[model samples]
Target: MSQQAALLHRSTHAIPKTAVGGQGCYIFLEDGQKFLDSTGGAAVCCLGHGNKNVQQAMIAQINQLSYCHTAFFGTQASEDLARFLVDSTGGKMTKVFVISSGSEAIEAALKLSRQYFLELPTPQPQRTRFIGRTPSFHGVTLGALAAGGHILRREAFRPLLTKKTSHVSACFAYRGKKDGESDADYVARLAAELDAEFQLVGPDTVCAFIAEPVVGAALGCVPAVPGYFRAMKAVCERYGALFILDEVMSGMGRCGTLHAWEQEDVVPDIQTIGKGLGGGYAPIAAVLINERVVKVLDAGTGVFRHGQTYQGHPVSCAAALAVQKTIRDENLLENVRRMGEYLEAQLRAKLASHPHVGDIRGKGLFWGIEFVKDKSTKEPFDAKLGIASLIQDTALKPEYSISLYAGTGTVEGVRGDHVILAPPYIVTQEEIDIIVNTTVRVVTDVFNSIH
Candidate 1:
């Protein structure tokens, strides 16, 4: 084995293999093994890998102007990308702040939400608390972490996390809905729960209600029931609090639409997007400000009292602009819809009846297969079993030659296991078949061995 490097990774017990190269949806390791990248490295690589156009765009920007402080100058790359994003939303979102990663974007969103209250005409100094959905995964930064509801992730850092953020039950129909309860009833119940929380916390004391339009890793691709988002948004509006949607994993065409909230029939006061923004070519994320929020800042302070050195980075913006242009010019959103339908059909047909396969959910190119110990009761295995982690490891073996994103704590923040598959937008029918067949084989083998 090679000597351990000086870098600190997520785990100190294990070091991952070195990825030497990648093309399309497959990554090549240094040892010459190839593996299909199903989850896009946590749903980030929308354009797959090695796209010449995005590369050239980034390289050209680096040649012309690589780095510049956002305070000093505004590059064409940032301005053009921001304009494209605004146009994409039909001016619903009037301003954009490009940052390096999803975590940073989320941090900016939280801070901006707080700042928005402070800059209001009346100045709501008491609006300091935030409300988010349970089992949500927003980001890792302190403010973002406080707003997130992943118990396992927040457990160790609980002492340092602010108590200002509170969580309501997520719109998880699989386990949350009762057998006799209708969708409308369940949504009303959840909405009432949110309202009661606001009342308990003092409605006027809340700054915003934040949630992912479609829940991601923490809950394993669970989209809300019909009218769920609208109800939540109404609650926020009733309380005069902002509605913030964290689309870090489900945005940028990953959910068939450019924005997942498009399907929900609701507009957010603030939105954070990453993962698919730069398609993993460069580290980038963004916060899109609604015109209402922009208006308050425009009228009051006339300046957002926040600054980051790498905000609106030129090269990252160039790469992201090219990525967005490719999605539009190539009409990839249409492909996402088509492939999403095909992928859903294949998954249900192949694994829906499997005993361990409790649920299959997601939209567009992003999907998740949740595992259970008992399908009849929907009982999750114990956390110590590490089923999700095992699937991830076994899928990367030489024989399998597949890579999947795995998650635990799907049922709240402690139990349940799931594996997510988020293939690239350019994937084809043949590749889809391979992905499904390999997934079936891998899951079957893993369980077969255990039995």
Candidate 2:
């Protein structure tokens, strides 16, 4: 019997190759094959695998203290990580709630947003609803899942998800914007739609408006157009609803900014960050609260009614702090911007004119290529063909030895397909060339096979 027989994998029919080790930009399988990690394992390994700094930090923390329940004791690791995150925001975000994953961070943000309203001097107990955007992915946990609009991920749990959440059209320009609509007009239209949704749901009854700064997974790496987030935040402000930004896949230097919102000209009332936080060295994520929300809670409850056994794991915090410091010390964000431009140019120069490639968009080291059945019409391929998955599988073959992140339901809830290429912050021009070249070959081969 296979050693993996007892383990339940994502797919039961096929056992995935065991990843025995990784370093820098490549992962080595048990069979000794090395594959370039273009997608950062869902865009998490910002510093890439096996960083000595992060590993040593985790080891040091473990030796000092590995487990300290937040309720009983506080560790220096957690406090330092929190301070570093708040300082990184330039004190715009006053407090940080360290957690174990992006899902937990989001769940905490949702609960905190609701609690903030209740703790307000006016005390809006009516604010029980949350408004999110369609084709957006927050997380998989119940609260986070309900707060998102990833139809396929939410399908099985539709009956269990909260009915209080409603969705508006995503700020996806490729398929969302009208042919002749100006950027200002497109922003206005989306803002108006959000306002209408708030009104329909009773603006006063909404707790917050949640969305990713850049749409990940469900819609691939789709960033909002200029002035898009500012307009949405304005609507949320008008309705007295907190604005929540989930930067799990786009922030922490993924988009050439430590915080993705910095580029959007807006600040979130509450923000959830993960993925690159620990650089895959350990599990860590955080919920950042602005002064407005922090002040309210301080004046009223003085306690956030949430707890997790691993709420502020010392080893995780240490790992994340080291990752952040590495990014700062090495000035990787600058590299991300420079290499990101090179990547975008290479991808467009090579694949933009392909018959099946429809749109290429993203920021920093993150990018997505949408495949279409009819380029002129922007029609998506049939869902059953699984173009994104096919491209991923093709890219991972021995000849290619590259990994790409795939996504479906780019058009509405279930049609369009896209694949994301989010390389590590340490990625170079040479690495970018390899990634793009492999992507071109894999995409070309996949489409040709189907044809």
Candidate 3:
């Protein structure tokens, strides 16, 4: 039997290489091969592997207090982390709920939004519905899954998902925008569609309108057109519904901003952040509650009716606190903005002429390259071919030795392929060249082999 025989991996038949250690932007396998971590493992490793600051912080917290049940007592680590997050928002967000992962943060946001309605001076018991954008991913947990509109991820759990959630068009300009349509017109049309959905579902019954400022996995790193989010927030405000932003994959300086919504010119009532929050140093995510919702709850319940066994794990909080501090102190966001421009320029310069390269879109260090069978038509390759998977598999080979985050169903929830490139914020320009060159080679190899 193999070493992994006792383990249950995501794929039953395939066992992945064993990673012995990681340093900076590279991972070392047991077999002595090294692979450059290009996508940060689903965009999680902002500070990259074996970061000394986060490691020491985790070790220090472990020595002081490893865990603390939130119900019994709160630890200094959690309090400090929460304070840092709130202060990061310039006091726009007043409260923070720390959790274990992005999915849990989203679940907490969902329940909190629901409870916010009940805690209002005049309870909106009927406000139980949630509105999300199609081709968007919030998380994999049931509550987050229900609020998400990724068809493939939800198909198996259809019977288990909540029926109270509805979806509208995602702010994906590459696929959704019509020919010759101005950005303003596209934003207006999407806003109208959201308004119609609210009217269709009875606006009074809605609890929140949740969306990612930059759509990650489901649609790759697709950002909204200017004024799109402002318009959507307006609709939610007009209907008295809470606005939530799921920044799980694109927040925490991933987009050259502390919060992705900072670029969108809107402050969400509740925002979910993870991935980059802890920078893969510890399992942690958080929900930031705005003053508007905090006041309502403070006036009424003075408590959020939710609890998790590991809601604020001290070690996790300590590591995350260190990660945030490192980002701020090292001026990494500035690097993200500077390096992001270079990465985009290099990608476009090299791959723009590739017939199979459909679109290259993103902000900061988060980017995605969608593949197509017909460049002029923007027709995605047949899903069965698994273009994204092929690129990912080929990129991991010893010859190439680089890791890329790949996604299918980019066109919708069933028929497109794209790979994301989210290098660590600490990445240098030389490393960016390696990533770009390796990516071009891997992509070219895959397509050439296919033909």
Candidate 4:
């Protein structure tokens, strides 16, 4: 970042280039730099940067009824959007608690799950503990921060978080898979670890097992192995616990399906989703609840205990409705699948042979390329080297001026490095080739300097 950018109000020392305009798969910087939006603004913007239908929907909603507090009344936009999501989800998910941001939606889900237990005929007062993975991200808010497992993010706020949650092993194959372990064996090991955590916590005391179906920031788009969710779900059910999938980064057609778990062949009792839900046209997220939990709340309290000022904001719902509709109507998910395969193939063909490249893995339009110092032994570059950070910084100079996502501490708490690519769903094969070609050049350039 330049001195002027550093002086601005953004929190991080690394200032982001301003996005001026976008159409289709391109994002134009304030200085008129056009780059393929691979990360979808941190896995947001599913319909791409500037979708015409979503924008028109937002405009229409504003003209009709922009903002209406739900305390007094509800709008047709909110009601229709709710029905749309519920129906699309196959009607098994009975309720949607909308909020302004992903973190807010997570907060609401946590509170709602806790309150649902309280409303039960046999109240589970002991169900105060939340079980989460070791290297996962839920959100950035204090409560959501507590539920997350990013040590660097949680370091400062450890004292502020409630001592109500416990950490477990994440189902990451690259780092967590044991020596010579089969996929089933690895999943069994992870499930055992979770079962042991339940035993340690006294199963009855736990509330939900929270995890990202495909991890986003912490592990750089790491998807759990097959049968991983099923095994984990069994453990949760054995303990009479709830399974909560944080699809905030993977759901809503980002992975070429409506839900990431659909590919996993399991269902979450409570699911949290955002980013792509409203396509960045308006800030929106949702906590999707199954019928079992809703029945408890319906029979006992008859009203939810939580509230948000912007819950179910009509304009946000309208924008999301249009975004979802366009995806279905235009068959954009097909494009996501086709382009995603091309992106993966190109990444593999280009960087699979690179010396510093350790692993490249992802699905659909979401992908990650991990880097290391020694490929034979998979030893990471020293953190002081800041390989990932350097790559992030170097890509933004006057020469390249491209935007990419970088991550660190991929192995343990403070080792390993990788970069993520989550292009928009509407990306074309031609544009994907450009993204792949530029990425190869960028990685080659960054590693050349470091080595």
Top model by lDDT, which number?
A: 3
Cα RMSD, model 4: 1.8
Tens digit of per-residue lDDT, candidate 3, span 275-325: 999999889999999999999999996989999999989999999999999
Off by over 4 Å in 1: none
Q: What digit string (tens of lDDT, one per residue) describes model 2 on residues 1-451?
A: 4855898988998989889999999999888899999999999999988899888998999999999889999999999999999999999999999988999999999999999988988888988999999989999999999999989999999999999999999999999999999999999999999999998989899999999998989888899989999999999999888999999889999999999999999999999999989889988899999999999999997999999999989999999999999999999999999999999999999999999999999999999999999999999999999999999988988899999898999987889999999999999899999999989999888888988
Pairs that clash in candidate 1: none
How many clashes in each structure? 0, 0, 0, 2
TM-score against native, each model: 0.99, 0.99, 0.99, 0.96
Give the runs in model 3 whose Cα sits over 4 Å from its true position. 1-4
Better of 2 and 3 by lDDT: 3
TM-score of 2: 0.99
**lDDT (CA) for every model shown?**
0.93, 0.93, 0.94, 0.85
lDDT of 4 by residue, 1-451 (tens): 4556636564655566677888876778788787667677777878887677888989999999888789999899988888988887898788888888888878888888788789889899989999999888888998899898888778888899988988998988987887899999999999999999999989899889899988888888798899999999999999888889998888998887888888998888899889889888889999999898999999996898888888999999999999989989999889888888899999999989999998888888889888988888889988888888787667666466555788876877578788888888887888788778878888888877755
Q: RMSD to the native, candidate 3?
A: 0.9
Q: Could you tell me which residue pairs clash in candidate 2?
A: none
Error of 4 at 201 (Å): 1.2
Clashes of 1: 0
Per-residue accuracy of model 1 over 318-420 as CA lDDT, tens digit each: 9999999999999999999999999999999999999999999999998989999999999999889899999988999989988778999987689999999
